[model samples]
Target: MKLDRKNLLWEGSRMFLPEHRRALLQQRKNATKLAVPKIDEQQLETMTYILQEAIEYEQPVLATYVTTYEVTCFCGFVDKVNQMEKYIQLSNGSQTEKIPFYLLVDVTWP
Candidate 1:
């Protein structure tokens, strides 16, 4: 059967492509929310101290944080730490990323 071009153009093919629309919607739903891990008080304090030391001495660190789909890892120098803002900035020579405290799972420093 030949598809109607007017319907395709107006409806953008999604109406005819239910499977594709379902898959796209599922992907969007999976990425829309993140399951951030729960960090206790002691762990939080330790991570804060490690970040403070790394930032003060200008040392690079490897940190792992939880994303929606996986655990993301980053290796860079801790440039700034703001307790008031509850975020830490990391620089990897080319770019900087501001990661919130709740997302950080592990921090490895030298």
Candidate 2:
């Protein structure tokens, strides 16, 4: 069977827009449904202090990497935490990468 280029292009483009719009709507809906835990100011301050201490002490922090619709993965030995962006900087041998805080599962003290 042979396909017409113009017809194929038109059909493909028609299919793409609805999928993209659905994905965008679903993402927005999911974001609206998220229920994040809220910590009081004092507790938040303490957690920040602890994180700073961990960074200064060179302790290994454990974190979990979460995806939109998957079982979370674990990341260990996080060397730096960026609270502002809710991400952590981790070291694997000589390499390092920044990952989201929601992905972190655990932390270990030095």
Prediction 2 global C-alpha lDDT: 0.59
**Candidate 1 clashing pairs, residues 3+ apart or interchain:** none
Candidate 1: TM-score?
Answer: 0.69
Task: Encode model 2's per-residue lDDT on 48-106: one tens digit a residue.
Answer: 56567766776655444445544343334557667689887778577676866554333
lDDT of each: 0.83, 0.59
Of the candidates shown, which would achieve the greatest TM-score relative to the real structure?
A: 1
TM-score of every model versus the real structure: 0.69, 0.40
| Candidate 2 total steric clashes | 8
- Per-residue lDDT tens digits for candidate 1, residues 57-96, read 8889888898777788888998877889988888899978
